[model samples]
Target: MTKFISICALVTSILLLTSGRPVKTYSELYRPQFHFSPEKNWMNDPDGLVYYEGEYHLFYQYNPKGNEWGYMHWGHAVSTDLVHWKNLPIAIYPDNNSTDKVKCTAWSGSAIVDKNNVTGLQEGSYKTLLAFYTSRGCGQRLAYSNDKGRTWKKYAGNPIIPEAPGEETRDPKVFWYKPGNHWVMVLYRMPGGDKAKEGISIYSSTDLAHWTFESHITGYYECPDLFTLPLDGDSAKMKWALLGGDGSYMLGDFDGKHFTPESGKKVLDYGQNFYAAQTWSNAPDGKRIQIAWMRESKYPGMPFTGQMSFPTELSLKSTPDGPRIFRTPVSEISSLYGKKMDKTDKNIIPGLKNYNLLKGIHNECVRITGVFDVKSSNMFGITVRKSRKEAGTEISYDVKKQLLTCIGSQMPLAPVNNKIKLDILVDRASIEIFANNGEKVITDNFTPAEQADDMELWTHGGELMVDSLEVHEIKSIWRE
Candidate 1:
C-alpha cells in the first residue's frame, strides 16, 4: 500500500522538476567551495549514509521546490573521495496518496548491503542494497537496490514495523550484528501522549522485514546512531557509542540484544552547527568515517540553504575527563593541499606587531595548523578573511579562562602541557576548528566581506610562543 503511494509521489516530483522554472546558479556570494550542497534547493539531516563498491553514497533531506524547507525528499549524491560529490536524482519522496492521510514525507534513515540475500530482494549475482527510512504516517519502510544503489524499488511489504500506539518514532539506523548473525536497529522514539519518554529504542530483525523490540535507552533524542570504536586504536578493546542529533554520545556495551551504558553522555563536537550526523556503513577497510548536516545558519542569496561538514574520521581515546570521542578530517583532505606557508618557533609580542607569514594565503579557502604556547598572553589567536580590523572570523584561546572561542561561541579547554594545537579549515562560508588534535572541535558559518582575503595573527596584553604554524591553500572540490 505504501509502496504504491511512493510511486505516485516519485512521478509527481519528476514532472515538477522537469517542467518547473529553469534552475538558476547563484553568484558565489556565500556559496561553499568544498562543502557538499545541492545544485539548488534546501537540504538538511544527511540520511542513508553508506559506502559500497568503491563509492560513498549520501542521501539527504531535501526540499526540491524552494529554498526553505517544504515537501521532503531524499536527495542523492555519490563520491569516491568524500570531498568531490556528484549529485544524483531524488531517491525517496513523500507518499502523497498515503492511506493514513497525513501528507507524509520521507524522513531520515540508514542503508546496508545484504550480502547474504537475507531479505531475498537481490537480483542477478549482486548483493541487494537496502535502505530503511521513516515514512511519516506510515512508520518504517524499506527500499532496495540491486545494481549498486543506482536505482531503487520500494518493498511490497513496507511499513515493516507499522506505526504503533503512543510511539512517535523515526530515524532507523540498522547495522549487522555479527555476534548474533542478524541485524540490529537503533531507532529514536519519543513516546506520545502524557507519558513522554525520549530516547533510542533497540529492535532486532532476522530477515530485515520482521522486527522484534529488544530494549530501550533513555535520555537521547532524534536521529540516533550506534557504532563501535576501538579505544586508543586498540581493536581488542572496542566500545560502542550511541549518539543523537545534538552530538551527545554515550559509551556502552552491546551484546546484540541490549546496550549497557559504561559512561554517561559526552559531547562529540563542541560546535554551533553540527547536527544529525551519520556514519557510512561498510566503509572500505573498516573505516569509521562520518558526516553531519551543517545546520543553524542560512546561506544568504545562494540557491542552496545548507551545507555538510567535512567528512571526519572518528576514534575513542582515554582523557583526563574520561573516555571521549575524537574527530579529525579524513586523510583524503590532504589531497586538497596547495601552496604551503610555515612559521616555526617564533615568539609573538604585543603592541600591534604585524607578521607577514600569511600575507599570501587564500583567505576564503585554506587549512591552517598552529601550535601556540600561551603561558604569557591573556588572549592569543589567528583571524582569517579580514578585510579590515573589525571584519573576518576569529579563533582564539583565552588563557585566563582556559576556553577556546570561535566567533562568539566558547567551549572549555584546558591547555595540554601549557600548549594548544589548533587545526582550522576555512571555506567560503564556514570555519571548522579542531583544537588539541580533535579532542575539541567547533564549526560555525560566517560571511566575510567580498574583499576580505587577508589572514593575520594577533595577541593581547603579552607575548606568546609559536611552536609551529603551517598554512596551506585548499583547492575547490567543485573544480576538481
Candidate 2:
C-alpha cells in the first residue's frame, strides 16, 4: 500500500509540471515601472476609492481567469502613501451560484466609510465600510466590511434598486451630501430610443439601503461623478463639477437634489487611453485626488494587460475660458525621482538632428519638464522611445495651429505668454503629458522595440529656445 501511494504521488507531480502555467516575475517587457498594475491577468476602471484609517483603498474591475475581459471581480489594493501599493485578495466575486445562473458580474462602483454607523451594521470597534456596486444585468447592490476592508460580504437584501424598466443602468457613484445631511448616488442609465432621457439619475439615501429618486441630469453618460470644488481655491466660492465616463465635464451648482450648469461642456483629458476616472471619496485635507484606467493598451507576450494612470490632484482654476479644472501629479511622485539632469538657455536650430541638448540621455522611465520659448519656430517638440531603427513617438507643437500633438492624438493648446511648458512622464509602455501647468493634457500608450529608450529635441522652420529643461529618472515602485 505504501509503494502504491508513492507511485500515485509521483504521477500527480509529473502531471502538474507538464501543465502550461508559468510563474510571473513582474519584470516582463513593457510592464509599467511606477504605475499601478495587477500582478497578473486583467484590470480596468478604478472603483471603490476611499480613504479610511490612514489607508487608501483602491478596488477595480478585474478578470481573474485570463488577460481578456470576462468573469468580472472586484480586485483590491491598499496604499499608505499613494505611491506604493499592496495587492490583496479579491474583494467581491460574481454570483455564479445563484439558482437562476444569471452570472451576475460585479461591476464599477464606489466605497465609503460609514463612520456614523448609519447602516447599524457595525459589529466591532471599526465602523462599517459600505461598498455600493452594480451587479450587471441585476441592478445595484450593497456590500459591507467591518474589519477595515480586509473582507467583505454582500448584503442579503441585494439588487437594492432592481433593474429599471427597459434600460440598462450601472456604475453607481455614491457620496455624502452634507447640505441635506444625506447620501447621494449618481447612476448611469442607458437611453432607450429617446436619447434625451439617456443620462445620470440622482437619488438620495438616508441609510445606504433605501433610495429615493431625486432628479436626472441629461446629456451625461456612464460613470458619472459629481463633486464640489472651490473656484480658484476660494472656500467662499464653491461650484459643482460633473464628469462623464469619457472625461468630459461641466461646472455647475448642486442644490442637494439637482445640478445647475454654469459652463459649457469641456474635455477633461484629450487622451485616447484614459477612461473611467474616479476620485477618492475622503481624501486628506479636503483634496480631490483622482486615478484612471489606461484603457486599450496592448501588453503582448506578458502576463498582465492593463494599468492605472498616476494619481493627480484636481483643482479648479480661473482661466481665460471660464472655470476650468486642472490636474497636477501628486507631490508623492517625487519619491520615485532619481538620477537628475538639467539644461537651460539652449538653442535648437531648425532641421537639427541628434542635438547635443539630449546627449547621453537614454532611459525608459523618467519625468521630463521643459519650458520652451516659442521664438520663431513653426514647430518644436520632443521625441521619446527612439532608437536608430525606429522613429518612436513624437510630442510636437504646431506654432501656427496652436495645437499640441502626441502620438496620433491632438489637443488645442495656446501658448501662455508666448511660452509652453510640458511635464512629461514616460514609462515602458505609456506617456502622460501635462502641458502648461496641466491646462491641457495628453496620454497615450505604445510598445517600444528593444533598446528603444533614447530621447531627442527637435525644431522645424526656424529656431527655438529652451528656457529650462530637467529630467529625472524614476525608480520602480515594485523594487521595495
Candidate 3:
C-alpha cells in the first residue's frame, strides 16, 4: 500500500512539476567518504530523522520513479548499526486530493519519539511518530504516525506555525530543552544582512505553541542542528553546540531563553563536502554521535553520491586559544583486519608527498601515523589512487588550513590541504576516510571512472614522510 501510494503520488507529480527539472537516480551519482545513496533511486536533504526503539530511522526527500527533487515524499530506511540499512515503505506522499487541499511536499523537518506520550500521543498510536516539517508552497506542518512510522497523518491544525519569516525559511529541528523551560526550535534560514549572508534561526515556545522569535546564533546557508552536551570531564558542565552549513558553533550556558558563545566559532569537520549533519539521540553510551551528508562539491542538482565518514564521537578539547571541537571515528572500524598486515617503519621529511611503497597488496588497508612537522607547507596534502587524473580515486589532506578533500569522477568538493596520516576506507564503489582518526574526515560515494585499485601516495611539491604504515582489510558496513 505504501509503495503504491508513493508511485501514484510521483506519477501524478510528473504532470504537475513546473517544467525544466532534471531527473536522477543512484546509477547517475557517486560520492565517497560516507555512503548513503539510495541503492536504486534518488535521495537528498535528510529530513524527519528519528532513532526509534532500537533502530535508526532516516527519512529524506525522495522521488520514487526518477532522480529529481520534485514530487517530494518522505522516503525512509532503518539501520541497527549505522551501516547495513533496510529500506522501509515510503513514509509520506502527497494526498492527491484537491490541488488546494494541503499541498504537501515533505520539505526538510525532523522527528522525535514522544516517549511520555504527552499531548495524548500514545506509544501505540500512529501519532507517536510526531514530526515537524515544511511543505514548500505551504507553511509548516505537524504530522504523526502511530504504527512505528509505517504510516503518517498530518496534524488537523496543519501549518501549525502559520508562516515563516521569509520564503527560504525551512529545515526545522525541534528539541525539548529546559533553558526556556519548554521546547525550542532551531531553524535553518537566511536572515537579511548588509554586506553579509546569515544562515540559522532560533525560535522559542513555552509549550510548542505561540512561538517567539529569538536570536540568530550566527548565519549559515544550510540545515542547522542544535543540541546540548555535557562538558568533556565534568558531566555537570554542559554546553550547547549548533551544527550547520559553514560548519558548527558551540555556545556556553544556554538558559533555554538564550545562550552566549563562550569560545570561538568552530568548524567541526574540515572536509569539502560535509553538511546537513544529524546526531544520534540517546547515544548508546550516553555521548553524542554525529553523522553528515558527505556531498560532492558541486551545486544543486542530483549527482552521483559518496561514502560517509564513520559515525564520529563529537567532543570538545580546551586549547589555550579556546575550546576546540574534536571528532574521532567510531572504534568498530578495526574489525576489517584479516591476515594482510604489512608493517613498515619508514622515516622521511614532514612535507614530502610521494613515498615509494611500490609493492602494494590487495584486499588490504593501510594505517599511517606521523607527528606532522607542521612546516610552511602546512597546506600538507596526501593522495591515494592517483593513476593519473581522469582515472583512479584520489584523496588529499591539507594540514595548513585543516581539511580532508577527495577528488574522483563524480566527487566534487572545494579543495583542502594540510598534514596527517590518511585513513582510507576503500571497498568497491565506497570510500570512507578519517584523518586524525575521525576528528577530520572525508567520505566519497563514487565508482571510479576506471578501477586502479592499487594504492599509491603522491603530493604536489616538497617532501612528506610516513611515521609508520600498517595495512588491514576494510570491513564493509554492509556485510553482516
The best candidate by TM-score is 2
Q: Which parts of model 3 have CA positions greater than 4 angstroms off?
A: 1-34, 95-103, 123-127, 164-167, 190-198, 206-210, 297-309, 334-344, 348-355, 363-382, 386-421, 427-433, 442-447, 458-465, 475-480
User: What's the number of clashes in each of the models?
Assistant: 0, 0, 61
Spell out the clash pairs found in candidate 2.
Answer: none
lDDT of 1 by residue, 1-480 (tens): 999999999999999889866533423678787888888888999998988888999999988888887677889999999988888988886764543323468888999989889988888977899999988767899998988887888899988878777668889999999989889999988766323577888999999999999998778888999999999999999999999998999899999989999988888888889999999999998889999999976876777889999999998899998888998999898888888898898888876446445656655789999999985899988889986555777888889999988877788888999999999999888999998989988988887778688887888888888989999888878774
Candidates 1 and 2 compared: the better one by TM-score is 2
- Candidate 2: C-alpha lDDT: 0.89
Winning candidate number (lDDT): 2
Q: What TM-score would each prediction reach against the true structure?
A: 0.92, 0.93, 0.75
Order of all candidates by lDDT, from best down to worst? 2, 1, 3
